[model samples]
Target: MDVSKEAKESLLVLDKQDGNKVKAVSGIDDAGKLKTVPPRKEHEQDFLKIDKHSNILENFFSNFMRQVKDPTHFEFFKIKTDDVEKVAPVIETMATQKDTASQEMLNEYRVEPSDYHKEQQGYKPIDESRIDWDNLKQFGITREGLEKSNSLEPMLNYQKSPGLHRISATFDNVKVDTDARLAFRETEDGRIALAVHGVRKQPELDRPYFGNNFSAEDKHNLLTTGNLGRVLDMKLPNQEKPIPVFLSVDKLTNELVSVRADKIRIPNEIKGVTLDENQKAELRSGKAVLLDGMTAKSGKEFSAEVQVNADKRGIEFKFPENQRQTQRQENGSEFKIPQKLGGVELSDKQQNSLKDGGTIYIEGLTDRKGQQYNAYVKVNDKEQKLDFYRWNPDKAKEITPDNKSKTQVEVNSNGKTNEATKEQKEPLKQGQTQADEPQQQQNKPRGMKM
Candidate 1:
């Protein structure tokens, strides 16, 4: 009998039932006799594993379930009046896309203290949306004939020393004067802050408005409504897109001081190198190109040089020294090197440096066809541009092995790296091994030996 090793090593086996109960046979001994072992009881096996913590946990769940089963033990909480008052306008606003302004609106526009107090006391509350526009004239607010208020003034403000973290601001003359200045600093939690000098105390005002455009009449309307705030936008060099900036105001001084310009969008595509009309049209929107070729020795004197232009950077690479035979497969046409060829990449620090205006050097990039090249990529934040150049030994800095590490070329922020594995083919030998020798055919075994 042919038995598997696992079957022979099994501790117990089930035997044929003599009546209702099955017999348990222990493993075969050296003499080949089966010994009987008794079956385990439920409490003996399960209760031994239970501990004090498990008992406590079981009792806790049992008590919770028992209490929940009692209808009289139910509990709930009452909703507050203020919360209901707040939620009504939000629901109304969603149903009808108009400002209901609820009680919070009056608070934001700084309604008279007496009126606010009456509203909070649950008496009559003011509703801004319900107010008539014609009655606004009675309150001394004119859209057309309103002149510029001397109450507001502008000043050039700087943070730390002069020239850094600087921006122009408009302040209320009744509170902050032309000599007044404000400085803003960002906290570790990513909040903008304000500090004021040359004022008795900060003015009482609402939060500043962060917007792109506001006419003179718009300013008048906002100021009259007690809704005055800051406005800011940035137009960067070489790019037509204007990014919106958020600013904070000193409520006590009524001075607009700080703006945090954090969100700058780089175009998904930009103007780069173009070859054909199709390529040119694609590149005008900032598309990248994949180059193919191999490194080879040129001339009878055998000077090694890379034949292909792998990137937009104008760098030429040589064979063997910069690139090695790293793999055998090709991922795509752009990745023209064999799977075995090793290439360089940008380090983590180098990538971060690029975002802040720095260059990353890459070398020893070989295509599947055994071509090699070097590249230099420049990062410019102001232009929102990344410029690529071919590696030039004469003009560019020579990268040492320690300075350059292997990385895939990043086409764009959202684009994945054209990465590949490094598995090279061993050169074929001219001679054969003993395994290749043919063996004499032996006569078929006349049957298995007993």
Candidate 2:
């Protein structure tokens, strides 16, 4: 098993004697030597143990992943099964494939060759008398090493077991089960895909039928935990769409436990935004992160450079107010929508739109200091689609009293302003419809309601 360079760097090396306690960290030096550092008294333990004969790079990942508990750097979600009915079919396919794949692989990739014709056709023996043993010795090629080589001793020379065998892989302390935590990976298309971890069984089976020798506690854990395998692609019972979440393993108990998926969580998990380390640094410099995959009220997807919201305050997904719905063929390519904003609590209208993969345009959004603007929001939309029209701010019309010919207005009793009215301004261009006017909104009066 080849571990990725990132995973290798994230792991720490340990001695098995430390038990659950991480004693020291080890890594491969540039010279291909094992580098070890004793545990600092104040440092946290993260590495797993390694046996004396094991390769440092290969074994480090195997140990560290199994022993390390509750990863701090990663986000987790306490995901419960939403719709088991929607997930069962997927599980059945996975289970069937698991069995089918095992047999196919055993036949396709046998450790031993299928046919022994080459071995039966033995190679000509080396002429010992003509061979210069002293000269070979000078080059460190000893007769003992040569005799042990596979060329001199083939399986055809001896009677051995016939037929193919399937070799099951096992990891010490790592238990395989039907249930697993899913890790999300960002795809080239800007979508997030689920990468499962901590389990080896198919989604259909609640328990692993092969590979694992179960203990009493293992059996107990299997029965108690809920499986998310089937629901990875299904929408939550309450949410408008499916979300990717990760599960964490407990170091102390070696069990799957509830954790928050930081990426999708509210304020506490707002850091789950596409803001990586580099993006965070840029955000600190008052730069906006251009994120994608958000849908607008008109079923058009758009992207924007979102400003990083203050920490501790929750972020929001919203669309601007009174946005006209237009089909893609109507020369509407870009949706001037805010993908992520800072706020908490969705209005009833916004929640309803999010429920059905629809979009919401919320007018009169305010910050803590009473500043106002509008926003557009959508739910259950694709992550990274690029074929929509770009929003042209210059073409947007400022909504004012001059653009109020369509709506009837009521005057006050005193002939003074009874209702708040926008400033009267320029008239519409000849033959231009109201729809052709730009749709830019002005900040509402402090106490005015839409």
Candidate 3:
């Protein structure tokens, strides 16, 4: 009749029956005391073991499912199972459920399909025709390519699971310049011993200026002043051989020399002969001279002499009397003139001078006779004989047209005028007598009697 007491007693019996294997289930008893109902011995043992190994078994199953899901894994396994008959239906059902579950999860999370699979599916397949097959054959990718395909499953596995990926690093193509010297050596135990004298970037010259017993001043001048004249005799310690020493201008010049006893010592050669101040000054002052001259028809000739200075700046010309003529011509020719000189006109000279460097000097012109005139000159790249002084406005007007005219109109205040033509005055009418009409009487009909 008291079920709670009965249940408690039963639980106590079960607890005593199972040795450490039974899991105890607790509850409140009839007396309001905490009581546990222990499981059966066999069932307690099985449940306890399951609880202990649940995580391990779950992980193993997950890993196995992941392997089975990969397409590349199926290809690699090459299993002869009847996939269409046995596995297809299960896969279809699983895929449909997975898709529905994925959609539900995505809706709950508000995630996009693109975000889920972008990294795995976005890459485009390489077009084989577009790739340079000859280059691939030359480079060694064909056999290696097949090997990569075979390892696709492992590769995909590594990519999908962050925990399984492995990485490797390597370095190659080590080199050093000719002027540099390695300053450290590796020991057998993989430790490195650094040299007391570090690497230096410089050429080593064997010269007679650096001797073991030379004065410090001589060594300083040899290195700093680049003076190859100084020579010093050095005696080796272990032998009677005398070695000519040369000064070094390198970073590691303070270090000890590592020279062998049998090596031959040679003199340091000088680069080249250098010029002294006097010779250099002479070369600076020597240059070709360019002179310009102008001649007129009066047998008068004028020239400008430009003397180049020693600094190579410019040639300074003494302002000559002939320069005045050039200045006058430049000023006078500011506007085009219609006159002709020699046989050429001012228009021709204006065209020539404007094309050239602004000043045109006429040469070898002493006389101007009628229309025959000649003066030599250069304009731009062309040379011509021009008549410089003949500019006649009347001749220009004849060749072109004299269409330009001036008209005058006079206005007078009074009737009197001087130098007035007939056409300029107002005309008067011909005379007519006043008696031609009959007179009218006052008593008569004034409208009809006249």
Local distance difference test scores for all models: 0.29, 0.31, 0.28
Tens digits of per-residue lDDT, candidate 2, 70-145, equal 2222211111122222332333333235487644432221111111112222334323544455654433334464
**Highest-TM-score candidate:** 2
Best by lDDT: 2
- RMSD (Å) per prediction: 36.8, 30.9, 49.0
Q: Which scores higher on TM-score, 1 or 3?
A: 1
Full ranking by TM-score: 2, 1, 3
Candidate 1 residue lDDT tens string, 1-450: 222211111111222232222222222244434333433332122111212112222332233333323312211111122232233233333323334654343222111212111112222322323333354344333223122211111111113211111122334422211223333344577443433343324332333333334557435533332222222454556657765443333323344333333322121211111134453333222233333332121101122221111111112222343222221111111111111213455566766555434466555554323434445655322122344455532366543211122122221111122312111122111121111112212322357544
True lDDT of residue 317, candidate 1: 26
**Candidate 3 deviant stretches above 4 angstroms:** 1-195, 198-211, 223-231, 252-450
Off by over 4 Å in 2: 1-273, 293-301, 309-450
**Model 1 spans > 4 angstroms off:** 1-342, 367-369, 379-386, 390-450
Error of 2 at 6 (Å): 28
Error of 3 at 432 (Å): 99
